[model samples]
Target: MIDRRRSRRSFLKLAAASAAGWWASLSPAGFAAEREPHRKPIPSSGERIPVIGMGTWITFNVPDAPGPMAVRREILGRFFARGGGMIDSSPMYGRAEAVVGDCLRALDRPEALFSATKIWTRSTSTGREQHADSLDLWGAGRLDLQQVHNLQNWQAHLETLRERREAGEVRYIGITTSHGRRHDEMERIMRSEDLDFVQLTYNILDREAEQRLLPLATERGIAVIANRPFRQKALIERFEDHPLPDWAAEIECENWPQFLLKFIVSHPDVTCAIPATSVVAHMGENMGALYGPMPDAAMRERMVAWVGDL
Candidate 1:
């Protein structure tokens, strides 16, 4: 019988080594230009960010217990070492925001950190309080991005977000939804609101955003942060027994994680895809998507059809 635990440890070791080797291969100029994973511009400001980013949802909602915190610290270390920047979390995610703070503190606070979190309450007063708590938890004087989680009382919170942005308390303001919920309302808000970003669930299997939301974001010049790139691990679990399509190599994908993430970030409208993982080895594999070649329109279609057949 296959020893799954042993296999996982071996794969993690190999992945870490491969990540180090990939970094060593880049030239100074390449590094300065940020050309390894490639970057996409935030449509509103034209500021570029790496296409692959880290997410702290369920993966980061850990207790203050030493062992669990150490694992999270290692995951954050691997993320920054691999050129990751944006780290998305929320007040809704239990202790995730606080855990992120702990991990960053242990890492001595990376300059590349682009912290993003959400205000997830109905009361504007509570939203303000929550936003302040998030900044405290993240140890950032000014948050890079603040979103309205699931569009909860977005109307009230967006006003405050705009005010904060104008005062330079936050760099960007936006809203979010997930699990394929509230697309119609999301679309209305996207049309009517002056948002710099939008977080939503989109992956290889969940293509509903492609029909309207993505195209509308492109038209409105809004940056898109794609969450659930692996559909909350459902995609991975579903395809665990299946082999990647032979043509996946055209995009330089060696594994399922890379294949899935590349599909999300390669879309024209997607500024970044935040894939969360508690495992350090999975972080390596996730960041690997940022390094390799990406798919074009034709290859993307093939990828879609290939996965659809299964």
Candidate 2:
């Protein structure tokens, strides 16, 4: 569950004061945690990653330009500066891989990056080709987690992924689906595959996963990555009009972004939530979810009831 600050101006004030005691600023009433952000373990290898990761779908597909490229650099800067890990991207996202690589190269490649990408092609042979291309584009020798995007030709790609995993060319292998589509298939696959992670759409509004996929992942011991957490910011545009509930401070959410992200990442079964953005300030706003104590089961119940009513 997540809490909130009333407005964007107030949130900016918190960001402005981030040079010192920024963690304290994430939650009013000074509810910041210690220096480190929250992290959860990958169930398979017990490798821990930050609760708040990033996604590069539409946001990182930038034209090769000084102006656009510089903005991306600042975004990555804020991300790493805030202790972010697990950057998820797909070759299907046009130039996002290259732009991310360029920005990472400019920043000297953050060691904190948990590089995640997907093989999106339909043919297993072409999926292998895309895997190699993705490495070159992202300038990575091996992907930390490689998923079969949208489960396209998933069976064959999973085999290739397992092969790479065995060869130390990949650390984790998984599958992804979005927008609440194909859960039956996802469930079937999850039950069968020797997967390390699974990515899906799980948010306050998209709670259908709570009924099945999340619980199943927990039972199967598969790490989960939540995508489209804001429903592509449509949820924010809808809920920002309403005043944040009074209990928002209890969970340390200082803005709508934090509120939404915390709701997803705080789930016991969810390892991380990947929210994409191009704005540097928005990146900071998203990372704010990493601080302070997370909302407990009781508070999460309250959040659902309050937001559902609104």
Candidate 3:
């Protein structure tokens, strides 16, 4: 009979070796913890953007967090170093634009950025002026993309954005909707408007977009930017106790965060997923999703089951 202790030791060694080999196969970009890495191209424009980008909503809006904002400077530096670039913001996200501007100005690497912001307001003049203020705050001479926030007076704002695009003030213009509650409205805007990108919420838990918005975006040749990838921490709460699915190993997901992020970004129509993070380590793991094996449809279905209704 084989010695039980010896058998256990041998099994442990084999497991360690397997894990090492799996890590070796993963995209080294996120693992190195050195810089922002991983990029996906916009199908519509063929312009590649970092697969993982930052969102400056709650994190950059602290009333007295410029000191903390300085920490974000280091984070942005690391982002630029690792090949990350896209930074999405909106006037509604108060003070976020200013903080981002401060960071970018300090970094002085405007060329490395894929700057994006949204126009929010009913009046065309207010929207246009807000757009100009966003430009000033970001310190970017020409914005990369502009989206109408929630289609609020989108018609008027789209005209303003179009004029800006014509004047070389911005490169791309689009729209955004979240919570999956506005799918019908989002669809109408998507179908009627000439948009280059569409920002919306899509994840394993929130597949509403998959039924209509995602397919529509694909058919229309519009790029998709996935927001709320973690479902506002719902994913972590649901999966914290559950063991990582066995197949998750196939995608190099050693952690739940990586698993969720990869699942959202795996869709071919998804140009990028902007998962927000204030913690650097969390940012590192989120970027890891950008690298390594993305879930195939079958795997995604399994992933949905593994995290069902949770």
Candidate 4:
């Protein structure tokens, strides 16, 4: 009745068209377009955090007076738009906590934040009260994560946090240290305490973390949050005149800051990295690193060698 050959040819044509469409949809750019951009998942918890987050240290601790608050709002807005929600602050950062609170109020984006702050005093009561005040300042009834700022009165605070974490007041508890000088102590604390995350300084220039702390954290299945990814601006100053190595292009790094950021974050143990920046453009550039290719072990070795030459 029907033309069998014609029907077969039509079916084959339709199948080829459908397959082409499917392949187009599965293409790399198509997949990237459909997916939200973020990298670095917690090994223990399976929580995927954007590899690049904002840090509120000196830059964020700007005067809580009228004019400064207005400017910070823009910075906060940019950070939010770029998928950067983890904001690290502390009592030591002076009025940063209050300023961030004002930003949150101005932005009305509380749920969009992965709020992180520290307990930086010396007594258990002081630490507990400080944390409570941080919660109040941020206007978040519960803290997403809190850390012992530089291990100051860490044991006392850790005890309180362990109880509170069980009671569900704090979702995660950890420790932090900024300088390479205290890394030994940081490692000791890591061994002694059960922590959810450990915040430390790690950048291209400061590979001290590679020696022991990072490896130990990975072994213990502890998450690592890198602070001072710019080395407090030291890396930029040191490597400014020198052009970025050609190999860096393979890892998607465009400049020294981004190169250093990628270097620290490329470590398999690093869960997330927070690079503080006040400028919106810089924030956008940092967020870009989260989307592109991350360095493999061989690439990481090459990266280290490249930096070593600098």
Candidate 5:
């Protein structure tokens, strides 16, 4: 087990000091942490994580109290029990890191967790500090993947990330943008930077990444993490009243969460798709996508055709 408190205190010192001169720190994985049915290897390390990872956008920004924290603990427990990995969060999400830390501690720190978070600060000098805060907040030993959230001050943060990666303080480095923002700039960075991963919005509705970013990730050997897989649950609410496609069961999609998530992760270039949910049942439905068959290129087109009509 990781001594998160000790790790946090140590990182606080490093994050606060002039040590490394904006060149340094935040950074965990355990057990096999990789579940069976389906897993994708990271392009840089070949580390396989489940395709249906959890996201903590609004779903995990709960108060640090027993009532809210207990529910979150169960929700996360359902995820790990379902063989999930690559739990993605950001400091920008209020109290999410702390909530997640409480949940992880509650769950006894599952061995299958692929902890991924971002450095969202625009100040390069405070970038390392933010990373440490995330580590401290999550009670995590280290971050498995540290991303430049929304590409804010991406260049400097990526430099610090590279240094941390070299020192084993960080594992993978990447940049992120969402809601179809800044594809042109993202493309430029993807081409120029030596990145291990790149996260952006890609879903049944958001196919823009397919035109450039998705293919570029494959070309550059950079893993891709798809966020807003459900368009922040708007897709689910929109389609819940509609019936699943008759062939939905062809891919073992039993609900909208499974249907929507399967469509995103089925894309060959997409490494994982994170759909946020606070409900235990919803989390179960999201994790179900990791099982059974996946949609193929033809089926994916059919998915777009169906959902795009609804």
Candidate 6:
């Protein structure tokens, strides 16, 4: 039976222990034995990545001032310290890529940094230039993944990405859309393109991707990265007054972020969920979803109904 009495504080304590490497020792069964952070594989390469990753959209777009930059550095430090792998950003987010470079430099370049960014320009030559600029901005020799942001001039940029992938400058290529925009075109790209990853917005409140994009990714063996898992804080503010459902304990969810994030990452085709946040406390809560039990299909259905009723 599940422990219904486990409060949010208790869950945080467990996460803190895990973060501090208290469970580093192996059990007699020859595994770490304690509940480790869940990982999902990239379908194209079969590479396993942690289900919870950091997103640098508005969150990391800070000025180079000492106080603001230091906060971002602490957030990045806590992220790597807590087993975060994929850090998603885009050139569209002003100064975010450069700030990420600052954080990496401050952290002495963490090995766990899975640098993922996008190309958001028109011409092939400009796309190439932007891609190179992102590399310099992030201080990465080669990007782990390069995507077409919002599919802007995707045809032209894709050609460049294909060449770069062949030239060993990028490990994977994909496209992304957000706020439920242009999914039909997104689906076409997913169907026709030989892409490795595709990112879209999916959350308890927004389920439009369920109809096509997600299943197509599964069919085509493309990894999925879910954005806006909290629906840009709209879902949180809507349910702040309401208490968590009693059954949330069944899957080890203690707060709204964990509850919502666990719902996204639990999807069979979702490789990871990139929830952007500037605050370290919220980042910790988001990473907490990486630990503990995830809901199965029946429970996910219940979650949908539970949130829909509110």
Q: Compared to the true structure, candidate 2 yields what TM-score?
A: 0.89
Q: What does candidate 5's lDDT look like per residue over 141-208, in tens digits?
A: 77898999999999899998988888777788899999999999999999998999999999888889
Candidate 2 wrong stretches, greater than 4 Å: 1-34
Each model's lDDT: 0.90, 0.90, 0.82, 0.81, 0.87, 0.89
Compared with the true structure, what per-residue lDDT tens digits does model 3 show for residues 88-111?
999999888898888888888646
lDDT, candidate 2, 140-196, per-residue tens: 898899999999999999999999988888999999999999999999999998899
Candidate 5 has its poorest 10 consecutive residues by lDDT at 23-32
Superposition error at 208 for model 2 (Å): 0.8
lDDT by residue for model 4 over 1-310, one digit each (tens)? 3689889989999999888768755653343344466666676577777777888888887875777787788778766665666888999999999999989988996455888999998988988889889989998888888999998888888998888788877888899999676898889888877889999988876778998999999988788999988876677778879998887888778877777777777888888888887766677677667666778888878877877897
Error of 4 at 130 (Å): 0.4
Misplaced by over 4 Å in model 1 are 1-35
Clashing pairs in 2: 5-254
Candidate 3 off by > 4 Å: 1-38, 64-66
What residue runs in model 6 are displaced by over 4 Å at the alpha carbon?
1-35
Better by lDDT, candidate 3 or 2: 2
Pick by lDDT: 2 or 4, better one: 2
Model 6 score (lDDT): 0.89
lDDT of 1 by residue, 218-277 (tens): 999899999999987888898868999888887778889999999999999999999999
The candidate, 4 or 5, that scores higher on TM-score is: 5
Better of 3 and 5 by lDDT: 5
Model 1's C-alpha root-mean-square deviation from the true structure amounts to 9.8
Name the 10 consecutive residues with the lowest summed lDDT in model 2.
25-34
